[model samples]
Target: MHSKTASSSLSTSSRIVLPNDTNVLGNLMGGQLLNWMDITSAIAAHRHCGRVVVTAAVNNVSFNHPIALGDIVTIEAKVTRAFTSSMEVFMDVYVEHRLTGEKKKCNEAIYTFVAVDQNGKSIDVPELIPESEEEKSRYDAALRRRQLSLILAGRMNANEATELKALFEQ
Candidate 1:
């Protein structure tokens, strides 16, 4: 397969926080938001690979602010990088006030997905080309994040993580 631009894999989802999606404090529940992000990010990964994709890891999530009930939540996800068979998707969550219509980013998440065949076996995916500054930044960071994750998972020795070592060498 040929390389794909990160922008070509962009995906978005919008939802209004409902009673079922909130906690007793009337704030949107983290689990509900996570579910939405998973679906949205999966779509982005699939778009990048043009194949079935499965979640391999939830690399990062930041619940920066609590979203109030009835707020309109929008999630924008895009593939940041692609490896042999996996792609990393980055997402930003924004909440719009129900009354004032004000919108602000409240959350961010990074997810990794593996492209799969009909039998669910991992398959190769096209390389990713990040055009925008933000996409390029995320693309570079994805390698560091992957190295950190590998270290944490005991899949790689800490000394072997060149990207992570750069952070401490400075």
Candidate 2:
């Protein structure tokens, strides 16, 4: 399979935080943000592989700040790395003040998706070629993150996770 650059899989989306999308406190609901993240990341994965994709795991998600109702929420996602059948996507969420026009990062997440056929069986995905310095950094870190996740899930022995072990050794 031919390798594709990170930019080729970049996906961006924006949504208004309507009243229905908010909590009682008038802030965007965490679940709503998660749903948007999933959709945005899946788009990136699909673009990277040009195949049907399924959410395999949500590796990490952090809510740094609260997003108020009426704010413009922007989500940017890109494929950071691709393995045999899965790809890692990094998503950043920003909230823009309608009046001030200021954008602030409110959340970030990492998700994993596996390419699948119509029958739902996992399929191979193309390699991701990171072009920018930031992309390269995320690409390099993906290996360590994968090893740690596997170890935590009990699918891989900690002793065998060289990439993750290196982090503790340093």
Candidate 3:
């Protein structure tokens, strides 16, 4: 039950959906959305760790709605937790309608990153610094999600795991 001694935050990143960013369905492609998430999350992680960081895993990514072509996708990322050399980054993607300005949450992702030295060797990240109560809550929530993911992964047999995994699908 490790907890952060402090917390960190990074600026938001955004991308405009271009014609090529969409698929045959005229919705934004998952890969393009994932690339936005990964890059923004990495930037947040590096800002927190103050060094180069490499993604260790995208623990989870879930898309809740279709992002239509020309939608502006905004990704907000923050460091939710840190352990030794690794940090967990939580990102939420918002889609704003190009004309009406209506906004909806389209995706959420959790990514783990490992800080690295100039040699590309892993290095310990600074203790997370939580600057606000909200940030602290987000950190705690991330921990709970991690624990739930582990529990679901460990306890479920293949068939059950597959069923539960289906619930996480787009």
For model 3, the superposed segments whose C-alpha errors exceed 4 Å read 1-8, 145-170
Please, what is the TM-score per model? 0.97, 0.97, 0.79
- Candidate 3, residues 33-69, lDDT tens digits: the string is 8888889999888877778999877888987898988
Give Cα distance to truth, residue 166, candidate 2, Å: 0.4
Q: Where does model 1 exceed 4 Å of error? A: none
Q: What digit string (tens of lDDT, one per residue) describes model 1 on residues 86-140?
A: 8999999899999999999887899999999999999999999989899899999
How much lDDT does each candidate structure score?
0.93, 0.93, 0.79
| Candidate 2 residue-wise lDDT at 95 | 88
Candidate 3, RMSD to the unseen true structure? 6.2
Total backbone collisions for each predicted model: 0, 0, 6
Question: In candidate 2, what are the lDDT values of residues 1-170, reduced to their tens digit?
Answer: 89999999999999999999998999998999999999999999999999999998889998889898899999999999999999999998888998898998887899999999999999999988999999999999999989877777788998999988888899
For lDDT, candidate 1 versus 3, the one ahead is 1
When summed lDDT is taken over every stretch of 10 residues in candidate 3, the lowest stretch is 1-10
- Candidate 3: residue 84 lDDT (0-100): 83
Better of 2 and 3 by TM-score: 2
